[model samples]
Target: MSFQRAQHLESINNNLLDIKGKIDVSFEFFPPNSEEMETTLWNSIERLTPLNPKFVSVTYGAGSGTRDRTHDVIKRIQKDTNLSTAAHLTCIDASKEELIQVAKDYWEHDVRHIVALRGDLPDNSAKPHMYASDLVTLLKSVADFDISVAAYPEVHPDARNAQADLINLKRKIDAGANRAITQFFFDVDSYLRFRDRCAAAGIEADIIPGILPVTNFNTLKRFAGLTNVHVPNWIHDSFQGLDNDPTTRNMVGASIAMDMVKVLSKEGVTDFHFYTLNRSELSYAICHMLGVRPTV
Candidate 1:
């Protein structure tokens, strides 16, 4: 091989080898709707548990049925695994009395952590009776639950402006959240800048970066559009013309995630949260690349 080709290969290898020290990781999973999906969810959890995540969180949905599913899954994970588990609680359609009961039930079951969110409201629906900050306060009243709230690096779609969004996050933190897990973004620099802004605003909470490994570009574009997350033109070009090629798409997606982790870790980010989407392969591979491995 040419000397330049050898140097190029070594450079790529060194980039992965350059990440120093230990990295902490957490994962997010959504509740399953069917027996088959539940099986898949458990299988994914089983696969990732050995990596020893700091915590695993289950996402909640809008209605009673979905809420029940989230509760059931949280209880099962707490019962079955030695891992720390968190349940997602939203203040969207539920009354304060109902939410209080849910909090009490979770605390009674030894579930001590919650991801408090003001869930998405439907069009034409009345204004939410409670926001995430109110939920944080309410949860604290019931128990000293370890709470995690969402942060938007790119401002939340519904926010009046960036400063207003930052203030809202501070309110949640001031109301008693432990840390903030950001919405996933591909641009590492955006997160770094947001972190700087958080510090300037007197917010001292840990701002954990959320990493979503993309397998479906079209689906991601739609989600990004709704959430106001910017998809760079380069990402679009990378996934172009690969709709028929799942294997290659997976490879490209994994490569992108691995690179993002490397950059963020170098920038003093020790904690990462993976949105597993109920599949473990991509997250497992990325964690392995970061030297997060199972212990004997």
Candidate 2:
């Protein structure tokens, strides 16, 4: 999906009026652990706000460790900026009523968007649950809030297969999910195929491809291993032996991500959600290459 190979790039750009040259963009942020980190996250938000993202989200930590902090960060974003804020909520480590109250809190606080999930359990937590008291039950309980559920493009590490994962996605949408956000993938083909499968399964929602700018290839590879997201050999080759040079590694990272986004733009995708990993340079660079610019 090279830029030159795309015949519809011009027409698509003209037709998708909401896209800013490339289209709508959103960002993902995790809650801070201290005052210094808080200042940093806010600075990051301020930097990206000028881009006028469709919305910005705060991530919920595994097993709900950051629940209060996540809410604080999100409410702060909504209060301090013009950006629409979405707070992530997970079903693990809580009961149904607890989940309901969280949803209502967002509603009362003038926050209408939610990124809902059944987050993974702690490592020592021998047998984690699916929040399966009923996945449908939980999603419906939160339905009054516009929620975006997680979609595993490579299929969830734990899911039986790609098709089985789609079936679970269908269940969530049927239970009133408004959208889905996929785990980040290096291959556009993985996302494209996932999109087609979602369509065939009768699940309709904005299935936004999540992009991760390689902050630390070693760190990212470790995380991908934990979640079962594969790092293709070719992608590894792009960054091999560059661990010693942070500057060069970042440049290579930005270029590779830009290359992927350019192809996706050609495939008629206009919306993107970036996993900032609490740093802005790589994501900012990649976005610039895709025609996203901060206002003067």
Candidate 3:
């Protein structure tokens, strides 16, 4: 009814229009644990691949237990899809020779991108290599692979402090990591501040914000605890009393994710990495909201 309100709404619409095709995004998926899950994983991949992601990464599990599964998934993606694939390589319970062999296997399969990580070490086990930085260096030495390392806006659980975490990230960059994908965080300010700190620390690699859509509040809280990411009380309050309502929960989750991306895009963040959890509905909806449509 008011001219001022009309102008405000117009500006918002124009901002959304401005973001169309101006953003780049990538998705992350975990290795499937079962045959049915494997079918689900490929279906999700096929659903999202048409969005033309920068690259899709398959996660490696803790220890060497999922090593073969991880490789099998990566190989299948590489063979079955047009999307560029990245394999998560960790130095958790493997020797340098074993790690190199895996890297070589990936190269032979034509997967060139490697998400280098210092994965969870076995209980009371000695460190195989020093850290992710070491893994980055080793990968570079083995081949000219495009490497990505993890960054934590809230600091890694094992780091002594935030500064130490940044230093570790710097080491990875200096050792030839091409990009840094951050751990998911709900508070956008945390990521903005971390981006500023990375710039101040002379880290020039593209640091993409990792976005996780929360379809389940309880599951999010548990994941946050494990990853050392803090979930604000307001988030819980927002989802409160919707315990048995899946439809409302998904609506609320989509709104939260869209709002976060809209704010980040306005703040000059053009790239995002979504932790898809091997599901496509939420992620596909979010990408569509951001104006990243299926290229097909």
Candidate 4:
């Protein structure tokens, strides 16, 4: 190999070695809607449990059916695994009183961590009763729960501007959130700049980077569009002409995620959150590449 290529390989190796045992990761899973999906979710959890994630979070939906599933999954994980579990709570259709009761139930059942969010409105015309900061405040009133709130590196879709979005995040932190787990982004520089902005704004809470290992390019584009996350052209180029190939897609996805973590680690980012999309193979491979191994 050329000297330049050899040096690049050595640098990658050093980065991997540097981050071993220094990174803390968390995984996010959505509540499964069907029996088969539930089985798949459990299997993913079982496969990842050995890696010893800092915590696992279950996503809450806007409707009651999904709410119940989220709670059930959280409870089951708490009971079945030794890992810390966090429940996602949102202020969408529920009233303050109802949300308080839900918080109370979680606390009574020994679930102390919560990921609070301002869920999507049913329509543009509907106004939300409470935002994520409001939910954080309400959850804190019920108990001294460890709260996690969402952050957007690209900026929230509904925000008037990026500064407004940052202010909203600060409100959540001020209200009682312990940390902010960012929305998944492909651009590492966007996240680093956002982190700098947060520090300059006097927000001292840990802003953990959320890493989504892309399994399908089509699905990723759709999600990115909805969330107003920018999909860099390079990413588009990487997945070009690979739509029909699942195995190649998985390899590319893992390589992209691994490179992201290595760069983030060099910047002193020790914590990461993975949006598993209820599948573990890509996430598992990424974590393994980062030197996060199963204890047992």
Candidate 5:
């Protein structure tokens, strides 16, 4: 951090300190594959548990291959940790009865929260089936559970426009979603604007931006490209000379997230959800910079 950036951050830090309003945070984790991956996931969970987040979510994969693994992970987390766990439920390959059975299983296990979405088309398939009808229908069906749906700041890649996507989001919230977490996005402005547009559309559910800190620009770019998140030219310039420098790349990633959060906090948005990618160092570093310490 430069002297100028440090000074600005300190000012922001002071606001973050005496800001009275607690900055609620949550995280998203993927299901682990092997024993080694499971160990990493638990370690990451234990490391971040002391932060006392609002909730943590585990994502179900694209289809059947990983569904059982996702279920096992969610069950273990709920049983092992004190954190409120939200299981992501997608309508892609599963039929309506199968989806309900999963929800019933979650309810039986005391897992109440569900991240509902009409998931994207499965990989290499000629096209996606409209088997689930739509997210709103699914939301209505799952109204018995505390549900969270996906939001898109820049509009869904498949949506006609951002406004139209916001309408779709409003439909889900109306059907009984308690919160809406956005698809991972790089730009904070998109989230802020999306929030305003949600209010304009008279939807009042909590809209949380999914923050994805980039450790590898090459990988992040590809993920962003698929998700409709644009990598700014300035970001490219920031990482231009640091391709081979891991330490510098990490610093730049943290700085970028910090800058974006500073602007977001100014807009009265305190909640954050990091797509941790099962790594704790960068997420922990960014939280420390924001003055969110582990209070045990």
Candidate 6:
């Protein structure tokens, strides 16, 4: 490598070494739908548990099987390991009573933290809570559980504008959410701006930046489209012509994620939430790059 490239690598190494033990992280996962996927998910959990994530969350969707699977995974994690697990709860089609029972069941199962969400567009006949803020309120009523709600750094797709986006986030926070885990965004500046706006609006809850380690650029683009997260042209160029090279793609993914974490660390952001997408190696490597090595 050239002298300038060598210097850059040295700087990154120094940053990683300096931040040892200061970085706190959590991970997000969806419930496995198949026997094969379940094995993969457990393998991931076993690999990542040694890194000591603050919590691992299981996501719930509108489908009945998805909901059951999510609860089963959360309960299994709680029973099978020493890790703290959080359940994702959504107010999509369920009534308040049904949601209450679900929360109660989680409490009884020893899960106390919840990632409350409004879920996807509700079925036309479903009517109780309308938004995430309402879900937050319902969770608060059910129990004094540690609650987390989602925030959109680039603004939610359905939001009219940025101002309205912040307003919705504030509502969720005001409804007793302990902190907001942001939807993943590539631009660190967008996250910083959103943080500043939250402060300006007097919303003091923690806004943890969600980091997505992209294993596939195509999948990332599809998600970006649905979430209104702007995909900068540079990101496309970075992965150009590596479609057939999985190993190089993984390396690029790690490099991009490590760079993003380093920039956020310099900005004084300590906590991060990784959307693991049921794959552990990339996230495990990124956390290791951030100086969070296994203790067990």
Candidate with top lDDT is 4
TM-score of 6: 0.96
Q: How big is the positional error of residue 92 in model 1, measured in Å on the Cα after superposition?
A: 0.5
- TM-score quality measure for candidate 2: 0.87
Tens digit of lDDT per residue, candidate 6, span 1-296?
Answer: 89999998898779888788888999999998789999999999999998899999999998678899999999999999999998999988788888999999999998999999988875545544468898889888988999999999999977889999899999999999999999999999999999999999999999999999988899999999989998888889989998989899899888988889889988989999999999999999999888888885
Candidate 4 error regions (>4 Å): 1-4
Model 5, which residues run further than 4 Å from truth?
A: 1-12, 18-21, 123-143
Full candidate order by TM-score, most accurate first: 4, 1, 6, 3, 5, 2
Q: How do all the candidates rank in terms of lDDT, highest first? A: 4, 1, 6, 3, 5, 2
RMSD of each: 1.3, 4.4, 1.8, 1.0, 2.7, 1.6
- Reference-based TM-score of each model: 0.96, 0.87, 0.95, 0.98, 0.90, 0.96
lDDT of 3 by residue, 154-267 (tens): 999888899999999999999999999999998999999999999999999989999998889989988999899989888899899998998888888877887788889989
Error of 4 at 127 (Å): 1.1
Residue-level lDDT of model 5, residues 1-296, one tens digit each, is: 89999998788768657533456778889988889999999999998888777888898877676888888888988999899999888878877788878888888898988888777676644455542225446545754777788888988888778777877888788777888888877677778888999999999888987888788888888898888987888888888888899999999998888777767777888788888998887888888777777775
Give the poorly placed runs of model 1, Cα more than 4 Å off.
Answer: none
RMSD of 6: 1.6
- lDDT of each candidate versus the true structure: 0.93, 0.79, 0.90, 0.95, 0.81, 0.91
In candidate 2, stretches whose alpha carbon ends up further than 4 angstroms from where it belongs are 1-20, 62-65, 123-143
- In candidate 1, where is summed lDDT lowest over 10 consecutive residues? 13-22
- Model 4: weakest 10-residue lDDT segment is 287-296
Residue 77, model 2: lDDT of 84
- For candidate 3, the 10 contiguous residues with the lowest summed lDDT are 121-130
1-296 per-residue lDDT for model 2 (tens digits): 98775856765455333334766789999999989888888888888888888899998875455899998888888888899998887767777787778877888888988887777766643565654325446645655667788888898877878777888888888777788988989878989999998898887788988888885789989989987788989888888998899998899888777767767777888888999877777777767666688867
Residue pairs clashing in model 6 are none
